[model samples]
Target: MRAVVQRVLNAGVTVDGECVGKIGRGYLVLLGVGHGDTRAEADKLWGKLRGLRINEDENGKTNLALADVDGEVLVVSQFTLFADCRHGRRPSFTDAGAPDVANELYEYFLTLVRQDVEHVAHGIFGADMKVDLVNDGPFTIVLDTDSL
Candidate 1:
């Protein structure tokens, strides 16, 4: 599993001109599930993200975790994170998990996140979504379960 985590002042997801999920003062997470990803991988990444101390403290130091600030989360499924572009001009998504399995894991990941943050929101699993966000501090982080 891979996730691109971005701190945002506010975020929302729209599908067919209808807003589905939204949040304020939180993280916008673009998550991808690989072919070999399992519940364990999802669990690990969720825990890591929840505890990640990227938010600033009262002294302006980046030392506060999402939990510490009572932040929300907006998770969006993005299989393109597994794209392999080393070859030709076109990128390949062979490493991405099948939709059936990927959707299941995606829901599982969301469940884990909601366990900690009640304000967790998510985009439609396989729908065409338009995401909007006001990135806070322009703080962005990429996390891959394989690296851990």
Candidate 2:
């Protein structure tokens, strides 16, 4: 599992001109499931994400967790994160997980997050989505289960 976490003032995802997911003062998570990924990996990744302290505190120090700031979350399935581009212009997606397995894990991850977050929104799995956001501080973090 991999995630690109971006701090945003606001974010939303649209599908077929209809808004599907949205958030405010939170993290926009672009999540990807790679081959052989499992619940354990998702668990570890969520643990790290839940504890991440990137939000600024009163003193302007980046020391607050998402819950501390009453933040929301917008999660989007993004298998493209696993694109293998080392070879040629056309990236290979062999590293990405199978669709059925990936969707199951994606839903599982969303369930885990919703348990702790007051508001959690998500994009449709396998849908073409358009995302818009105002990046807070332009802050972003990339997390991979292999490193966590």
Task: Superpose all Cα atoms of candidate 1 onto the true structure and report the RMSD in Å to 1 decimal.
Answer: 0.6
**TM-scores, each model vs. reference:** 0.98, 0.99
Predicted candidate 2 versus true structure: per-residue lDDT over 1-148, tens digit per residue: 9999999999999999999999999999999999999999999999999999999999999999999999999999999999999998999999999999999999999999998899999999999999999999999999999988
Deviation (Å) of 134 in candidate 2: 0.6
Q: In angstroms, how far off is 92's CA in candidate 1?
A: 0.5
lDDT of candidate 2 at residue 74, scale 0 to 100? 97
Model 1 agreement with the true structure over 27-139: per-residue lDDT tens digits? 99999999989999999999899988999999999999998998999999999999999999999999999999999999999999988997999999999999999999999
Tell how far residue 126 is off in model 2, in angstroms: 0.3
What's the alpha carbon RMSD for model 2? Answer: 0.5
- Candidate 1's clash total is 0
- Name model 2 segments beyond 4 Å from true: none
Error of 2 at 2 (Å): 0.5
Model 2: pairs clashing at backbone N, Cα or C within 3 Å: none
Worst 10 residues of 1 by lDDT: 113-122
